[model samples]
Target: MRFVIKVGTSLIAPGGRIDTVLMRALVDQLDLERHEYLIVSSGAIASGMSKLAFSAKPKSVRLMQACAAVGQSLLMYTYEQLFFGKKVVAQLLLSSDDFTSALRYENLQHALHELLKLGVVPIVNENDSVSVRELVGAFGDNDELSALLATAVKADWLVLLTNVDGFYDSAGRGQKLVRTVRRLTPKMEALCGEKSELGTGGMRSKLRAAMMASENGVQVAIANGTAPQAIRNAIERKIGTYFPATKPAPKKRAKAAD
Candidate 1:
């Protein structure tokens, strides 16, 4: 099965630096040789903050861009070192226009197919170094980008990994995880809120992306990236909030005469 795994910055760089422990754990948990796997990762800016000596997320777009430029390589390097002998990993820096442009989109599609065929895993991230809009947070966050990529690649599933365990609802006195959401309701969508200190996306963006993917025939799962067996659990429909695909009715076989 083809799956797009979007890793949030919160999980990758919770405070500022690349959490090697978490990264190692995630890498060790992943065993997707037989499946077509794509990772749309966030955390360049967060990772850059440590390298650039910034204590907090920068306010300037130029500074943010600089951070992304500095952090992107570090992000990939970590992935490279972890997946060294286990699997080959390739980096893909993308812009919103890449998908808007028919040729670029198709070329990317071809390149990804080739990489997968060659037993390589493509690790994708927004081209924050040069993408003006991306730096300024114009286009939707990586959550939305993952949905777009999943659609472009016609992936069977899109699993969004975040700090939150799953979609939560305010129950009686506390918040409770909503395990299965057949359809995202208006109330549920309203629950999405502010972003973390290090990243732009939040629960709302993920829900929107999930709804979009589900509408276009791609199942979606939102789970805690740090949790044990997160990816496996999401794929197995054992944990997280699952959104199954909604497709056109299948043609029915005609009834035979008795």
Candidate 2:
């Protein structure tokens, strides 16, 4: 099955620095030949922060863009090194226009299909260095981006790998994980907590993304990336909060003998 796996900044770079061990393990999991994979990754800014020795995330758009420019290369380089001798990876820096424009979206679909046919893993990230919208909170930390890509590519599953185990209900005694969500409601939205220190998206954003994908006929799973075999487990329905795909509306038959 085709999968669009989104890895958030918290898992990619917990404390500004990129975690090579965790990344390598993820790469190993993706090395399997049975499945086609597309990666939506978030770590450029954090990596840049590490490179520049910044104590905190930059607030200014220009400063953040500068950091993204510096770290984009580092992030891709790390992926290349990790996937070497296993899989060829291509980087695609995208803005919202790429998905919004009719021509651009068609072109993106063709390119992504061709890349997958050639057994290449397309690593996608927001063009943070250039896109003002993306830099100033547009894609909800790439959760929305992943969902869009999943629908565009007609992926069977969109797996979101974050720092948490799954969507939890904090109101019920301790935190209770919601295993399966056939439908998303406003109450669930109210359960969303704060965003991570290094990441812009919180559980709310992830749930929104999941709902987007599910509505588009794509199954979604949100799981903790720090766990062992998280990606595989999510796919196998062994872990995470799973959202089953919503069936498309049936077309009405044309009037006969009119």
Top model number, lDDT: 2
- RMSD of each candidate relative to the true structure: 6.0, 5.6
User: For candidate 1, which ten residues in a row score worst on lDDT?
Assistant: 249-258
- The candidate scoring highest on TM-score is 2
lDDT of 2 by residue, 1-258 (tens): 788999999989989999989999887887448888999999999999999999899998898898899989999999999988888999999999999999999999888878887889999999999998987778888999999999988888899999889999765678889898887789988988889887878899999999999998898999999999898898786499999889752232221311
lDDT of 1 by residue, 102-157 (tens): 99998987777777777788999999889989766665779888988888777888
| Candidate 2 CA-lDDT value | 0.88
- lDDT agreement with native, every candidate: 0.84, 0.88
Please report, as a residue range, the 10-residue window in candidate 2 with the lowest summed lDDT.
249-258
